[model samples]
Target: MTIEGRHVVILSGGISHERDVSLRSGRRVSDALIKAGARVTVREPDEKLLPWLEQHFEDVDVVWPVLHGVSGENGALYSLLRALEVPYVGSRPTAAMLAWNKATSKALVKRAGIATPQSIVLPNDTFRELGAASVIDAISKGVDFPAVVKPVEGGSSQGVSFVNEKAEFSRAMVTAFTYSDGVLIEKKVTGTELMVGVLDFGEGPFAVPPVEVVPHSGVYDYAARYNAGETTFFAPARVSEAVLAEVSELAVKACQVIGLADVARVDFIVDESGKPWFIEADPIPGMTETSLVPLGIQAAGLEVSDVYARLAEHAAARGPRNTPATPNLVV
Candidate 1:
């Protein structure tokens, strides 16, 4: 579809911890869409956003929300868009909520015969009421050493920790709890970290070439994710042909299993034995200068602007799917 005269709103920069990253992503998307001959607006979500959107609803073709972390990924923004009878890119609100929760999504993927790290979910109240010391003892006995502790629902590794020894377990749990009321502790799997980007674009979902991330400090934390030189990325990842094919196929299946549409990034940890273990899926992936989605798109022999423009066009043409019905007259 032609996007020559399309008007798109790229919503970004919400109250999430990844607000800065989202802003950068919105800017990149806006520039890309403009290059594709579409009128673009980069708007940070605020109190007046809904009113403004309602006023200009007919003028806009679609809304491409780049709000990362909680602000955008939690499904509220998408739900609001649906309520407004506006077309938008990415997954529906139900799918967004399912994918945003790491533990829940992992469970769903595992049910589809995917291998994921064994983990436990603990609520803040449960941990505190049960006594931290006792809970720690139970966790130590249940989960193996060298585990990963992170919030149940968050991105950009905001409050993630790697626990190598039992002594470091408490601090890791405490750090994770600071970010979310629910925390996930999984037995850390040793492997090469790989990321796969999937693009549906109205057709059946297909996986792009995988990208291998090599963090300078051995941890892809928030700083390493956003900072330009903090990590070195390899497009068409340095992996065996077998590994690549398996990872790519798994990525597409993960998207289907999680009910994601449009675009998503599935992270995996290929163990030393060459087995891919599903980590998590990001429905609203980062599209900043250092993000992996753009790299994946480029690796697949496509331009970022063209891909985004096509997404906008496809969404606009589809119109609203879950728009609410009007009330009946009381006569």
Candidate 2:
């Protein structure tokens, strides 16, 4: 099924923490698709999504769900797309449930022998009733101070904080709770932060060169992730070939292990030992010029417009993912 001039519907801007960023991504993709000689439309997700799709999906040769976090990254919308019989990008419903949960993603990657930082998942009551001492003790036993505390189910680094002392530990947990019911207090592994973009074009996973992020001191928070000029990205991360190969391999493994397909990006922390520590996998990584994935893809000698066009073509070629529980199949 060739999608030369077919309509591409890009979904974005839901009522989530990353709504603005998602909308920016959607706009970028829409513009790129149009530049590539394809018809494109950008739509915000709301109560009218199903109705709008019911009328327009068939005409839409590919659905580019550029939404981020909850409503977009979660499995619900993906499941809806599957039922609609519309070809959409990114992971399926089952995989999203696992990757969306910080605790679950880490557990799965760790179980698969991928190196992930130790984390303590704290429920709300445990933080309020059990006290910060309990939280500190539990996390301190496995990790040390200068740890990262954030929502167990979150993206774009929302509700994330760095706790350097006992006094800030509880506050960070509270901040994390502002975004989610549970908090993940992870062991801080200080090192160069790297972002790996993995794209599945129905021919296994291929990783775009990794990008090194150098965030200003004490500013690698949510703002730095979405907005511009908060960080510097060095595409084709300056590392040895062996380390790069290993990083790429682990990133692909993490995506495959989580059952993510179509396209996704994996973030990592390359420790002093040069070992990559799995952070989180984003099914709908941002596509803004400031996005890490686009930079890496371009550094790999592929234009952003080509990437978007191929994604649309990939969706049109590969149908639904959840049907019959098959990861690789064309219907």
Best by lDDT: 1
Model 1 — TM-score against the truth?
Answer: 0.96
Per-candidate RMSD, Å: 4.8, 3.2
lDDT of 2 at 88: 82
Estimated TM-score per prediction?
0.96, 0.94
Question: Tens-digit lDDT track for model 2 on 152-177?
Answer: 99898889988887777767877888
TM-score, model 2 to reference = 0.94
For candidate 1, write residues 87-116 as lDDT tens digits. 998787877888899988898888888999
Q: Report clashes for each candidate as comma-separated counts.
A: 0, 0
The lDDT, on a scale of 0 to 1, for candidate 1 is 0.88
Model 1 clash pairs? Answer: none
